[model samples]
Target: MGEHAAVAAVDDPVTVDRIAANLRELGVEAGDTLLVHTSLSELGWVAGGPQAVVDALQRVVTADGTLVMPTHSTQYSDPSVWSNPPVPDDWIPQIRESMPPFRPELTPSRGMGAVAECFRDYPETVRSRHPLYSFAAWGADAESIVADHSFENAMGEASPLARVYDRDGSVLLLGADHASNTSLHLAEYRADLDTGRVTETAPVLRDDERTMVEWTDIEHDSGDFPQVGAAFEKAHPEAVRQDDVGTATAKLVDQPALVDFGAEWMSDHR
Candidate 1:
């Protein structure tokens, strides 16, 4: 019912296959560390459920490679802290049941949910810890990986993603564009590096998982969202000028159709 992907009112196997074929055409191959930020609802009824979607992607990037998706378990001790209003409040209990924190000891699973399962146990890679920055510095070129943007003046505390974009290395934007991309928070990270203001915090995770890490963020709300979005766009236009982007996932690349909301805004506002 929100901004996630879906299969029209009538299920479409044809669309799923198209998504599969599109992935193949995107140059997905073995051993490419990749990061994927997505909405499972986007690929309505993918064959074999979420695992099937993971399987198709895994096949493309096989052989000593890594595929990363954000298994973000920003579990709040208080439920009011949760975002993604699209998800039903009733679904939270089940969401808690279906997905847990990245269990380093457990083998990563695919299909358990769909997108999140693909990144099971892969949080350390996607959710990196930088004393000064927030957002996963995921990508082959660490120089390009950035994480520092945050909403200023908004919570008594901060979320893990509040610090990082959630990739192991290289970065990609699937459901949203680079404008929505959080990894580039790195652009602001450089500023924090010099200010000596970046600090660490511990955030509670779903299923009682806890992470101790350093992070920096601005605390503004919707007022900040607009500004943060602006800063990100100006900082990473190169990411938008391309069809494919590698992210911090286990060396994976998600080939998603790119949309430019920033451009639309300029046309309407400017």
Candidate 2:
């Protein structure tokens, strides 16, 4: 369903307390590390909006558990290949030269939604320095998870996704689908499949000054992620849990199991 349809699925008003209660019912425990992809609108109208959602998540997870969300600033991508709202041919060089460096404190996540943006802005949250695919995390292991995001391996074993996997994290699909499931990218990297690499450029801080840096990383493809998620649900039915949080249907899955299964699936399919 489209986002509008998901929003229309709920009619009742949702509050922080209601969301907290729903989270508990949805198998979100106090000490579980959760990487969440959310759509605030799908939960119906929230009392305090995204902040209330963040508050409710934090309340449920408490101070012990970690909360993470993608804070990718995709606009920092190479302008040469821009297609969506593509810029003029002559403007590419200007954009390449003038684009501001990615500052974890300053760059805003492009399409990550209001809740993720608010989470990234939280005082205690620590964000990775990856120019394009950075993630923001909060709570106990936030710093460790986001400490060193390798430029050469954006979502590979060196990235936060691997750390979350190693910690036995959970993937929370809050009114979102497999298309937004970033942990799968780690599986793509692990698979024996031969996806090509692409050279991308972004403005990053080097020696406390902004500099345009070019790097080559694996090209990502999510065309089969939906199928992969379906196969995972079928293969490990016990590990995949589903329930309603507010009006949105939420799914919680074991991150390790999903990635393991995804790696095998990608090897065959990709």
Candidate 3:
């Protein structure tokens, strides 16, 4: 939505304090490890825009709590799988060979929205090493959550998703649905679904030079995530707390519970 339309959509500008208050009311607390997915535009007009949202989260979660966001750089992946405005096949080889290495301090998150992109620049925020499925984190548990991200099991047990699961984290969806809830991908790995592995390639920094690396990762799908999320929410209402923050609808979920329920749901339904 455009600025004017966004401003007109809400009665008051969404400020950091207001966002933080709403978050607290939605059950966010200090020292909680939280995974957040947000849509800035969905929050209507804001006084400080994306930064305000980030600040509000930080304010509520505090330094003792960890804040995490998916900072995936999908452009670094094999160009052969590009479907949103797919490139010509002739350009694939050139793209792969010339693609820049995944630099944790520099590479921007593709399609992860403005809030996450802004959060990436925050002081002391560290990102994982997974080329395509990296996650950015800040606060007390940042390093642990982002440590040792396995390239082959990007969203599986070796990934930050598992670390968050270990920490008993919460998932906050701000103007985003369960479809954008990446935690479910972790469940996919735990589920009975024998989703085969797919060969993937990414440019990485090795000995101060960019080189292409290949690995096999489990084939994960989100086609059924919405169904699984709906079923889980319906069956376990106490596990999810839904409310509104600014003009956008928000959901605070128990990450481990959601994953467990999602794994069971997928196993029985898929």
Encode model 3's per-residue lDDT on 1-270: one tens digit a residue.
789989999988989999999999999999999999999999999999999999999999999999999999998877788899899999998998788899998999999999999999999999999899999999999999999999887999999999999999999999999999999999999999868889998888989988778889888899988898898899989999998999999999999999999998889888
lDDT of 2 by residue, 1-270 (tens): 455665566676688999999999989999889999999877877778899999999999987999999999999988878789899999999998898889998899999999999999998999999999999999999999998898887999889999999999999999898988999999999999878999888889889998877778999998899999999999899989999888888999999999999999999988
- Relative to the true structure, candidate 2 has a C-alpha RMSD (angstroms) of 1.9
Encode model 1's per-residue lDDT on 186-220: one tens digit a residue: 33332222222322243324356644333444431
Q: Is candidate 1 or candidate 3 better by lDDT?
A: 3
Question: Whole-model lDDT, candidate 2?
Answer: 0.91
**Positional deviation of 16 in candidate 2, in angstroms?**
0.7
RMSD of each: 10.2, 1.9, 0.9
The lDDT for every candidate, in the order shown, is 0.38, 0.91, 0.93
Off by over 4 Å in 1: 1-5, 9-18, 76-114, 121-170, 192-270
Residue 264 of model 1 has an lDDT of 36
- Candidates 1 and 2 compared: the better one by TM-score is 2
